[model samples]
Target: MDHLIEFWPILKRLIKYAIPWKKKIILAFCLLISGATSEVLGPILISYFINNILSKHKFYFQSTLIIIAIFIILQILAVFFNYFQSIYFNKIAVRVINKLRNDVMNSAIKQPIYQFDSQPIGQIISKVTNDTEVIKELYDTVAPTLFRSITLIIIILFAMFTLEWHMAIIAIFIIPLVIVIMSIYQYYSTPLLRNVRYYLANINNKFNETINGMNVIQQFRQQNRFKKSIQNSSQLHYLARMRILKLDGFLLRPLLSLISALVLCSFIFSFSYFKNEVFEVGILYAFITYLGRLNEPLISITIQQSILQQAIVAGERIFSLIDSKKQEYGRNKKRFKTGKINIKNLSFSYSENQKNILNNINIDIPSKSFVAFVGHTGSGKSTLANLLMGYYPIKHGEIYLDDKPINSISHCVLRKNILIVQQDPIILADTFFSNIALGRKISEDEIWKILKIVNLFSLVKSMPKGLYSILGEEGNTLSVGQKQLLSIARILVKNPKILILDEATANIDSGTEKLIQKTLSFIKKNTTLIVIAHRLSTIVDADLIIVLDKGNIVEFGKHEKLLKIKGCYSKMYNFQLSKY
Candidate 1:
């Protein structure tokens, strides 16, 4: 019951997608009716043959053969119509699944960054893959089965009534009883199926996590631990499956028993009451055959109840994700051009109750000036950079670009003029030129110029295919320094107004660092540069230096001025000087 309630929203959404296929669905219905009518008439024709030809010894051989031929032709036509109906329904299922998957993926990509941080990657993957598959099964298998079962039941009832009204009434009575049993079964079985689906999702999530982190497990020599965890998850999944199967077994046996009992009572009553009438043995046989046909559709509907419930549970989960709050995008907002930045009373914290990660940070960067942020680990340097980049919302203050509040500007506008290169570079497995260009189309001359600026021109020239050379899997073939240089070269081609290098030189040797630093300095003439570094020597010639401690600006001045003060920056500078 709970699972059905949960899935109700998803079913409603699915029904919206079905609207486009109403014509095909109508055609399918017409085919189903035609097929059922032909099926019902088959037994009646056999009965006619037995009574008229064998029993009564009728000798109209030519007409009898024609009637038999017509019946065979009708059966063949019914098979063709059934096939068409199946094909049409399958098409509708595919259309619905495609639309649903697209909507879910779009919603996921638009979700706030914090949401991605909070949720497990494996669980998200399960939703996209496994949960969507359940929805597809609902449309492809359960929906058609349900519709066909209903059509069969209706046709069977109508045919039985035409043959013997009293017997039809008795059969109808059993239907109400069957309905009550189904209701009870659904009420009990829904929760069990819901548990089964939940456990199954967990199992999938665990499997994905294990596979993605296989390298980590091997590195730590924790294969046994992972194996044990997988075993435990598998056992839980098995138990959940068993619970559902047990419930199904209990419901199925009782339903089948009741159906059998109904058939027996109907037969006994027919034999007792109609024995005196000149009823043909063929008619009796046909009625029994119809009774046999009736049980199958009923059983099919009963079995589909479990699958329908599972789909509903899946739908609920999918819809919940789709309806989650997405990252805010400003509408009808004015766009801004790149210029100087101002941070005022900017006290920021990741969580509301947690300690502030940035405290009363007041700073100003003149247009095209190179500013450096220097601090020890856990000093909130990266957090400050994230704030400046608009990756995190300002908590207790405002950031202004060109003396206008950054919050007033749209993300698209901000991203257009700002770029950041991080410590760990993002390298896709693609041709060297494609990786450099990302998705943008740039001139070959521009690509070469950027590569030359980063001193990667010789390396590209040495490759057999030059810029067309393929980088396998996250550019695994390239050294760390080379990857970093490639990333810098990629960004240099874009030529943004504001450039941020967040620990960009941390992984490279001093020689490579010097080359990158020289290139960055050359570019700083026109672009405003913000360098976050632990190596004070790299930023010794910066226009200004800001020393951060526990999210607060403990000291802020030029290197010479801060050094003369002998504050936090002075101690760090002197320590580094002694080490060198």
Candidate 2:
């Protein structure tokens, strides 16, 4: 009862996914009933043959052949119905699980960016993939088997009562015993199944982290440590599975078989004790056959308890993800016309318990100017960029674009106008053209023109398929400079009003930096180009440079003016100059 109370709501939610295919589910169940009825009738026909025809010395060859033919036809019809019902159930399960996986994926994507910071990628993937697959087993295997077994048990019970009322009363007592067994199984197995799922998810997380960091692991010769970690996770999963197996071996089929043997002995003794000259052989045969059939379903029901528990656990995880708070966007449809940005009294912390990442930042960035922000590590450079992109909610700040509050801007307008190019650009495994256009309907001519401007036209032309060549996973075929150029090309096609280059030239060669500089000269004429500088040489020509220290703006001036002041920026620039 406690398990049912916990699982009822999840079952109710699962029904909604199945409701869309109600017609097919209903037809399949009807076929299942028909199949079970046919199975019940077959034993009765055999009993009639044994008592009325074979024993009485009245067997006509044609009559006996007719009865035999009818028996075969009944069995064949039962098989036919059962097969089609299973097919329908499998089809519905596929469609329902597909919809569920889509919902899980959509929910994961819609969660706030900060949520991803707290959650592992592998755990999220496990929810969408592994958990959904287990739920699929509920629909396809556990659900259908339980329904069919119950149907068959009910039909067999009715047939038993028709044979002998006293025996039927005895047979019905097995149901309560089976129920008790199932209840016990549920109590022991639910927690074990939940543990199995947790360890499995942990294994997936370890594998994902290892695969993504294989280079570092091998470089530092830490493969043995990672291997041991994954093995420990797998060992935990195996122990849980073995515990469930031992519980099942002790509680499920063996207990039912014991009851079956005792019941069989009671039925045989009842027949011997109640015997009379008029006792019919057909009735005795039918009762025993019905008894055997009854045990089959009882055994099946008990065996499926493990699968049902697993489904319940998987459903809980999937629903938890689906119920996570999604990032909400405003309804304002206004787009930025001029890229002027204003920040006033801005302060932010990643969490309430942590120190502020940005402390009372105030700045006025004019339209169509080249501005640079330079700071030491942990000096709130990336945090400010994240806030400007609206990746995190602003708790105590006012950011405005064109005199409108940043939060008032609709998601569509903000995404379309304010774009950032990170240090390591994301390159997909697709043709160069799709990577640049990114679902936009940019002309091939315009794309080629931009490639030439970025000095990548020669690289593309040299490829086997030119712009149509596949970039492979993460654009592994391309150099770092080439990938960065591709990121810029993506920005060029969008022509965003406010473009941020977040350390874009921090990892590239000198030649690529020069090309990027020339490209920035073109971009700054009509867009707000904000550069977060790592190498001071790139930002030396900026119209304005801001230096930050420990989340506070320390100085703001032209590069030469800052050098004369000999403050933080001057020391940092001179240090980098000394390195080269």
The most accurate candidate by TM-score is: 2
Q: State how far residue 139 of model 1 sits from its true place (Å).
A: 1.9
For model 1, the stretches where C-alpha displacement exceeds 4 angstroms are 1-4, 57-60, 276-280, 332-335, 576-580
Cα-based lDDT for every prediction: 0.80, 0.90
Q: All candidates' TM-scores?
A: 0.92, 0.97
Error of 1 at 266 (Å): 2.8
lDDT of 1 by residue, 1-580 (tens): 6545655666787678778889888887788778777777887787777777767777788968977898898899889877877887788888888888888899999887677767876666777887888888777688777888788788888877777676666666656666776777778776676676666677777787788688999999988998888788788878888877887887865667677577757776776778635445766666777777777777778788778777777777788889999876444255445558898889888888888878888898988888999888988888877777777666598888766676666777677667788898989999889999887889888899888999999999899999999998878889888888998888777677788899998878998998898789777987889999878889988998988988888888888999999999999999988997
Question: Model 2, 1-580: lDDT tens per residue?
Answer: 7777878898889878999999999999999899989899999898889888977879789878988999999999999999999999999999999999999999998899999999989889999899999999888888788999999998898888776788888889899999999998999898899999999999999999999899999999999999999999999999999999999999998889999888888877887887644347787788888888999999988988888889889999999999989977677787778999999999999999999989999999998888899999999988888888888889898998777788888889888888999998999999999999999989999999999878899999999999999998899999998998899989899788899999999999899999999888888888998999999999998889988888999999999999999989989999999999
Poorest stretch of ten by lDDT in candidate 2? 275-284
Q: Against the hidden true structure, what lDDT does model 2 obtain?
A: 0.90
Alpha-carbon RMSD, each predicted model: 2.6, 1.5
| Clash tally, candidates in order | 0, 0
